[model samples]
Target: MLYWFFTNPVSLSRWADKHAEGRKLFFKCLYLFTAFLGIAVAASGAVESALAWMPRSWVRYDEDGESEWIASSIAHVAGFIVAFFVTLKGAELATRIRRLEEESN
Candidate 1:
């Protein structure tokens, strides 16, 4: 999935030399946001799966037993937080691009 996201032709930027600074910045921000979001979502899914497969007995506080679920849950939550920020940044950049286009017309 990560490979597909990075290599997809549809998301590639192909601005002409006359492209405005605002447009370039918008595309840069949009791409970075998408990449980060994709990574976060993938990481979250992996952590969730690991957490789910962990045995419940491991979480019962046995001596020498580690609670893998706790660590996995933390990772999942962190990914979610980063994903939220990336999404917000992406929306803001997109809106800026739209406004600039409207004004240029």
Candidate 2:
């Protein structure tokens, strides 16, 4: 997963060429997607932890009633994470489409 975060598609292909002997296309695609997922998870976890450590002014909890601050913060992080990964994956897919088109031409 870290490999994906650190390398672009071309680098990944080269790494596979060097290390993934006899690997099927299915596994390579799986690895790429899973690495993306790992990135998303790491980002989301960081957001959650950052929120948890934010100043009182940034994240205030209700003292008298059922505190919804934690849930709110979590929801915020979750939404950001979903949006981030969706956008990232969409870009990656679009790049793949363009690359395939170029190859076919």
Candidate 3:
């Protein structure tokens, strides 16, 4: 299934060369993003569990709920950042490929 996506010879060749040139930068960014996501999810889950385990005394007004809210907000922000960068990179790569194709025409 994934193989089919990259099997077009022309696209494959172009993509391979482009990827090779950008591989280090791409993987560095990818791994950093992945790590951020992992940390954010884990932190959010931990916050939720902590809130659940809290004593009745800690369940007062919304002020007491701020920590969980902060954790969840961080997770959401990290997700948005990763998605934004991924989309931006994909669009840039697509544009470069299209331009190359047009030039070769």
Model 1 lDDT per residue over 1-105, tens place: 345335431233334114545576665566666777786988788767766766655443436765445656666797887677866676566457756766899
lDDT of 2 by residue, 1-100 (tens): 6566245554555566677778746545765576566666766676666676554455455767544556446746685677566657855774686578
Candidate 1 collision pairs: none
Q: Which pairs clash in the backbone of model 3?
A: none
Q: TM-score of each candidate?
A: 0.43, 0.41, 0.37
Compared with the true structure, what per-residue lDDT tens digits does model 3 show for residues 1-105?
A: 345323333444455466667574554455445545555566556555655544444432365554344444544565566556654665466558868887999
The lDDT of model 2 is: 0.62
Judged by TM-score, which candidate is best?
A: 1
Q: How accurate locally, in lDDT, is each candidate?
A: 0.60, 0.62, 0.53
Of models 1 and 2, which has the larger TM-score?
Answer: 1
By summed lDDT, the worst window of 10 consecutive residues in model 3 runs over: 1-10
Report residue 17 deviation for candidate 3 (angstroms): 26
How many steric clashes does model 1 contain? 0
